[model samples]
Target: MARSSTPFSLHRLAVALVSCGLGLHAAAQSANPSDSPPSSTALPGVVVKGASEAPLSVGGFGDTPIAKLPLQASIVSAERMTDRGLISLAGLTSLDASVGDSYNSAGYVSYLKVRGFDLDNRFNYRRDGLPINAEAAISLSNKGSLEVLKGTSGIQAGTSAPGGLVNLVVKRPTLELTSVTLAVSERGTIDTAMDWSRRFSDGHGNDKAFGLRVNVEAAKLRPELRDADGNRWLLSAAGDWRVSRDTLVEAEVELSRQSQPSQPGFSLLGSTLPDAKSIDPRINLNNQSWSQPVVFEGKTASLRVTHQLNADWKLQAHGAIQRLVNDDRLAYPFGCTASDGTYYASSYCPDGTFDQYDFRSENEHRDTDALDLSAQGKLDIGGMRHDLSTGVLFSRFRSRLQGQAYNFAGTGNIWGTLPTVADPSLTGTNTDRTERSTEFYLRDAVQLSERWQGWLGLRHTRLHRESWQVNAAPGAEQPTRYSQSLTTPWLGASYAIDPQLMAYGSWGEGVQSDVAPNRAEYVNKGRALPALRSKQWEFGLKSGSRSVDWSINYFDIRQAAARDVDAGGGLVERVLDGTQHHRGIEAQADLKWTGGGVVASAMKLRARIEGSSDASLNGLKPANVPETTLKLQAHQNAFLTGLELQAGLVYEGKRMVLPDNSVAIPGWTRLDLGAKYEQNVGRQLLIWRVGVDNVTDRRAWRESPYQYGHAYLYPLANRTWRASVEWVL
Candidate 1:
């Protein structure tokens, strides 16, 4: 683990500052009743000054809650994130429906999934308004908050997979100073974080706006899956300056480093093991564990810029570059050896043959480059108003995997010694694949009258993919593959039932054509690439007041051209004329009690997957999706004398592992409790907090890493305890 070189913990300070700032700001702003503008209520939902674009919320897609999106959307907040003791991005999928977790082939390193969709794809990720994905696993682990939008959101998120997209919102610096937290848990785990934010802006003085935020975090965890362990160190900073009153520029940057040792598999996909209490020797959990014999490391660096143009118009540009290095080789373990000289029940490879497996040793890396520019503004014409937003996005995603394989002819042990391996000349299987996607889109929300509203959106996307494979042998001609193109459309409508409620519906089409001249296209000869689209129906009531807020929604979503493989082992996933229906009900309510000091928030959700026979996924239980889910929370801070107290609870329903419909899992419930106290030390002050997680030690299985047949449950952490103390400066 890299040692922290920073002066203090930034994360702790940032969180405390941001939380307090927002809370106090809201209170202060509400108290000043005379500071109301022309459109007071409308501006509340439009805190993101300058312009409104697409009616899509940056915190989550659309104005609805995660559970109320036209499709199922689940949101995990930063506060819940830390309280749940999440260690990696995979941890966020625990309560989500149809989302799975995987420990990737490299081991220890994990990835998340929703309905078997490759959500880690770059296009599916977004921070604020910027889009990105982790080329390496480390980036996924350090995220602060995540919102998983289930089903196709191509109309809003642009070109991408059809299953779902996880939009991770990173933590930012705030105007708070001095915050700290420390924790120790089972498995010799330890973590510490600190954050501090200082504002030079003058709301109390000369009005010269300036602020700086710094965050630092580090942790060490020994996972239960295997003998492997991981360590991470992170540092991030942000600064903002106001150029006069109409223009402002803010720059943000982050750096992180992570390293972990090799470990065995913790989850399984399909296993023939018997369901006995204490039986089945062949069902060993580590039977399929593949180890990487070398150590691994990953690093990331990013910079973002935001500028405000005017109160109703603004232009922003953002660019980021990243490099990923995996310095290790996969080694087949001896434990996987079968007594009869066979590996598992799969006949793909006999006892110790090389061609049957993709095991190899080598260095692999990927470079990511992205630049996105967009403008958003609002135009109000008398009683008629137009909330318009437009933007262009360009991204380059590239990866290179070059390594050596042993025992090509199945004749040698091919151990530590570097063997001649394959004729490296034939470019057996090494390539640099680069994909670039450019998109231009515009969306306008037109309010024609007091009760009627309409939205029009259009997006044109062009995807170009290129790959070059070079062989190590002399005169080996390298191979290159390239392809380009796709377009999408969107529309929506809403009707106001009263001052506090509204009902709306939307329809959109998303497209993704294979941009490469792969075997599928070459074999079919320009017959066109695979494409998928979604037709969605939604209706809901949104209404609320200062003391109570609530919303309810019902929706049906159908997808076309879903991907599915054929018996010939070919890309048989074609555009089948089939419809898969996902219908659900969701509602959220928050009540403020105890003299406006205590608040109670609760959410209920239920979802299902119904597929048509024509889609080849007829009865398959929509992979990694849960059939039902529910959550309830109650948070309150009461001041009695000089101390404050707080408490909360969370629950999750049962989930499924695969789309095969062969297995079912039970539900799990977890509880969290915490409290804080504060006092004065001369002119300075001190605040203390303590909390406990998983008070029940429930044996919960995380649906992620569902590949292996093991009971792949993400067991609740054994009653973790934490304590923190901060000084208000």
Candidate 2:
């Protein structure tokens, strides 16, 4: 079926854009330029907006505070990501209740799922109010913080999975004079980061100024076991030149590279027997692995121009480019081996002795490039208190994938080890595929009244895909091109109940289109798959005192029109009329005392697939989603010395992945501790910190799918401790 429901979807999109543009013009003309001077010292709305870490910056969406965005939204600050030593996107999402193991596949690649909906990079990301869900992996560096918007984000970040959206805020040059951090952790790891900013003003009648800000971070990340050695380094620089008091130009760039060995992916099986750790732990299978030897790189650069048209109106135009490349290999056992010599295709292993009979050796390579451009501006309506903001975003993404695989069968039972294969020519084959997408969107945030706010958004997106198999028989035809298009809309509202409390609710819709046309499904039926879409609703409360703050929220999300399966074990090539939903609550609190402070957060989630006939698919707990998760922390400054004591505890409830509802797994909890001291001797500065992760040495397991449907678990990184000293100039 066609993705658009309305006969005039394209026309409607045009009208929406025109209406927002007209409203913006009115606001700009009516606003008075003398309302507030454009100066850092001015404690006006602009300064307040800039200082507060709201969800309006790049990689951020939804104005709902971290506590009230969604009962399930999880906010991980820069301090927290570093404290947990989670430097990768996958690591950041692992602990998120909304994005569990369902997206954490065996490969290091990161996928996000919120509210039971899949959120791939294609159309579900934002960076500084810019669309960044391009074809390439969005590399992040010198980030100030991160926010995960729970539920469908059609209003905040159009065309995405209902599961959620992750926004990353980059560090910007500010008036803040200085800040520094240095630390060392488990297994002799070290990290140091610094921030510097300065402003220069022209003495002429023209109020012109220039600012330079630079943030640098370097760290050596070493794994606990042998054969795992890796390092992470980042450099971020941003400079802005205010040509005139009303205009400014800015530029920034980021670079990062990572290299490491592949960890093991062991299957998790459920069984009726009490002694069974897995459904079939005894059925030992061959371990397959792959890794990027040394070269894995990602890069990004952007340029922007900001102009102030008048007191009520301002505009910004931004453009950027990004590129990413990776080369890797995979070695896996395709099936089980018999005691004698032959190979069989099943999970079971015959006889007490195991053997490796079936295997596939393969290599993979990928390259992606993307381009983005957008214009955003804010205006105030004349004679009205309404402040209107509108913008249009355009982006293009392209990707290339090429690979070859070989099979070795009948290689006698050499279980748990690599098997020797004969016949080189018959063992290998190759294939190639390419995908591209183009998206355009316009959104408006309307301040309806002093106590109420509303937002309206619309978007249009198109996707094209093609694939070919080079090793096929001469007469076989390569796949032809396939195309699809979709249009989406969003609505939201917010209200202030009192000085210390506010309540808000939003309903947003998003879509995920197929990478290619379902040729098989087309041949079997008359129509192609419709774009998958999801809807979300959320409400919450916020309250705080002079030294303490807290927030709570409740959310519900639903997804429909998803991929179904057929007899051949391949995607059914058709959309299934099914629904998936999640309901949950989230809470957080921060407190400060005369000499000490505390921070705490907790989550409770319950998700289910509402309508599916398969017993295993019906009501089965969503994979990797813990029913309860909590984190508590306390730190104190020495009353008589220059020392600090810190302690934290984390708890995770049981999680399971099963097709049948009959089998399940239990939950676990863990604790950690640390201490640090600082001192100064002459011209040098010295600081030391010592801590242990998983102090109790608990054998924690994280739900993972190294192979589709074949549950795998990642063991806790292991109990580790380290200490370090630093100096300042």
Tens-digit lDDT string for candidate 2 (190-243): 777676777776666543377767776677756564334556566777778888
Q: Give the 10-residue window scoring lowest on summed lDDT in candidate 1.
A: 46-55
- TM-score for candidate 1, please give it: 0.73
Q: How far is each candidate from the true structure, as Cα RMSD in Å?
A: 11.1, 10.1
Model 2: lDDT of residue 568 = 62
Per-residue lDDT of candidate 1, residues 1-729 (tens digit): 443422133334334433443344345345433455566455344222111111234422224342222334556666556544555666654444345554443234556654444454556666555566554454433344676665566655656665566666656555566656565554566777766777785575644488777777787855443334567677777667765566666666667666655432222222432122222211112222332344334444455555567777767676766666665433322223344564442211232222212255456777767777777777888767887777887878788777455322222221222222322222245656777878887877788887888877787777777665544456432445445556676676777665444556766665555432323323332234555666556555544334444445554456554433353545443334455545444444444443333322222223333455544455344444554444444555565644545454445455554445455555566676766667788977766666666666555543433442323333344455665565566
TM-score of model number 2: 0.77
lDDT of candidates 1 onward, in order: 0.51, 0.54
For all predicted structures, in order, the TM-scores are: 0.73, 0.77
